[model samples]
Target: MTGPRGRVFRTVSELGIHYRRSPACGVGSRSPRKGPRAGDRLPDLPRGLQARSSGPGWHLLVSGPPELWPDERIALVLRGRDDLVGVHRLGGESPWPDVVQGLVRSDGCLGFVARGADLEGLRAYLERWLPAQHG
Candidate 1:
């Protein structure tokens, strides 16, 4: 799909095994009874990850680095997939539990939180994230 600047983006898919096309604006198509189709919104970020506004604007935070927190491996694996919308590196090494990197959907969409850390924050964010995106 073409974005605001005429940049093209690929649709989301399951490891390239199946693909879900994005709508014109990347907001997704509306469903008859369900409201927005499943393909309309970005899928949930893997567990233990949070995107939020930081001093620098937006940062992707993780519980820890992959070598420390097993959950951090999710981002590493996702970075290798072809079905992604966009990928960006953190650009520098940070100590354990610091903000790491960001992940976006097929529409170049990454989520943000006001403030969050660790699993507890992730859980809380999902509570709001799911309804805001899916509902």
Candidate 2:
């Protein structure tokens, strides 16, 4: 895909997950300290989702069965889940995340974010929100 500036962006999608390149870990807060700071290694990334170094920040990627629709907008659902986000803790910090960016692909890339919902629910949710790729 091409960016607004006409810069060609590489698309990463496999299984049932989609990937989008983000500047940093934080989606809303401008303050870097509140989220995954630059150069910080993501702790306990979800099994289905992944983040890799994208130039200065990271490229959040979702992987799953190829049948999964490649919906770039699906990443937006990651907001407001502070429990799953990784931050630089001083001491006595819980390593587990309640919600983080990424999702468990149908192929089993389990992510750190625990939606508390089952896989069937997730599939239904996706079907309701995004259009089918094969249909």
lDDT of 2 by residue, 90-121 (tens): 12122232222233332223222222222343
TM-score, structure 1 vs. true: 0.26
TM-score of 2: 0.21
- Quote the positional error of residue 38 for candidate 2 in Å: 22
Cα lDDT tens digits, model 1, 1-135, are: 257333322333322222235322211121123211223332233422223221232233333234543545443433323232222332223222243323233332334221112334323333343322221
lDDT, candidate 1, at 65: 34
- What is candidate 2's local distance difference test score? 0.29
Clashes of 1: 2
Alpha carbon lDDT of each predicted model? 0.30, 0.29
Off by over 4 Å in 2: 1-117
